[model samples]
Target: LLYALLHLSGFEDVSMEEVKNFRQWGSKTPGHPEFGHTAGVDATTGPLGQGISTATGFAQAERFLAAKYNREGFNIFDHYTYVICGDGDLMEGVSSEAASYAGLQKLDK
Candidate 1:
């Protein structure tokens, strides 16, 4: 599903073939989406909690950039970071910790 979304976002390497070949050795669509290995992936994450932690980091970076560069009527860093997770992910302590930090920091975007 995510590989298809990446393809829809216009990343050429995430084409249908790669999506179909997911989890196969030598395929770009590994079980864990790697930053450099996949053209559109932004981080190298392992388990569910790790993915949330990485996303929180990205969101933190985005917030920092927005504060530093954004101005009235000229927003330079207005993009957002997004993620999806299952019930199992929420059960992880790391994910909860990352979520708590993001919430406390008000990293809504």
Candidate 2:
């Protein structure tokens, strides 16, 4: 599911081996969706709510980079952040906490 999303996001050059090897062998996707370890992943997340929480960071970073580097015509660093949080996200307190934090930070986009 995630691989398809990455492909749709224009990560055409991404590969399965790269995704599987993002983290050390022992890790389950290295505890989450690791952006740093994978070629096209946007963040490393786990513990249910972590994925959405990290999305906020990635979105903020995207905005920061766009504002810092994009010129009047050049719109580099502009992209949307997406997350498919599971049922567990709402059941867990940490998930609510992350959601609250995102809301408090005004990360609407």
Tens digit per residue, CA lDDT, model 2, 1-109: 6754564566644455544654557433443666675456656666777777677777788878888999988888767877788898778877787778778877766
Over the stretch 28-87, how does candidate 1's per-residue lDDT look in tens digits? 999878889999788887786888888899999988888898999999998888886778
What is the RMSD of candidate 2? Answer: 4.3
Candidate 2 least-lDDT 10 residues: 22-31
> What's every prediction's RMSD, in angstroms?
1.4, 4.3
User: How does model 1 fare in lDDT?
Assistant: 0.88
**Among these predicted structures, which one has the highest TM-score?**
1
lDDT of each: 0.88, 0.68
Residue 41 of model 2 has an lDDT of 65
